[model samples]
Target: MDEPRGDYWYNLVTGKVEVGAQSDWTQLIGPYASREEAEHAIEKVHERNRSWEQGEED
Candidate 1:
């Protein structure tokens, strides 16, 4: 099977999803593998922060 190759970006300012450098780097969240993953960028950030906090507490 063929695989898809591209980076996904979530626009913080416009609350949008982009594929492969659609907008400037400063406005984007990531480099995520899929559009769906990019769409949940905010949630992922929060989750990551929580993990970091938990780690610090340990």
Candidate 2:
């Protein structure tokens, strides 16, 4: 895959941290500023879900 110029991405289908968009948009989860952020994408999603469940807003 050709590296796109942008933030890192987390490929949900492959569960991998990519330099940018490396897969279909539907299968990717980020324009995260860093690879570390992309790596924790799932955790962030769960955190948001839990916060929403508790009626919390950022």
Q: State, as a TM-score between 0 and 1, how close model 2 is to the true structure.
A: 0.76
lDDT score, candidate 1: 0.84
Question: Can you list the residue pairs that collide in candidate 2?
Answer: none
- Model 1, residue 17: distance off in Å is 0.2
Worst 10 residues of 2 by lDDT: 1-10
Task: Please provide TM-scores, in order, for all candidate models, with all chains considered together.
Answer: 0.69, 0.76
Q: Which residue pairs overlap in candidate 1's backbone?
A: none
By TM-score, the best candidate is 2
lDDT string, candidate 2, 1-58, tens digits = 7544458998888899988686899999979877777899989999999989888554
RMSD of 1: 3.5
Give a tens-digit lDDT track for model 1, residues 1-58: 6335458889998898877777888998888888788899988899999999999999
**Model 1 TM-score on a 0 to 1 scale:** 0.69
User: Which regions in candidate 2 have their CA more than 4 angstroms from the true location?
Assistant: 1-6, 56-58
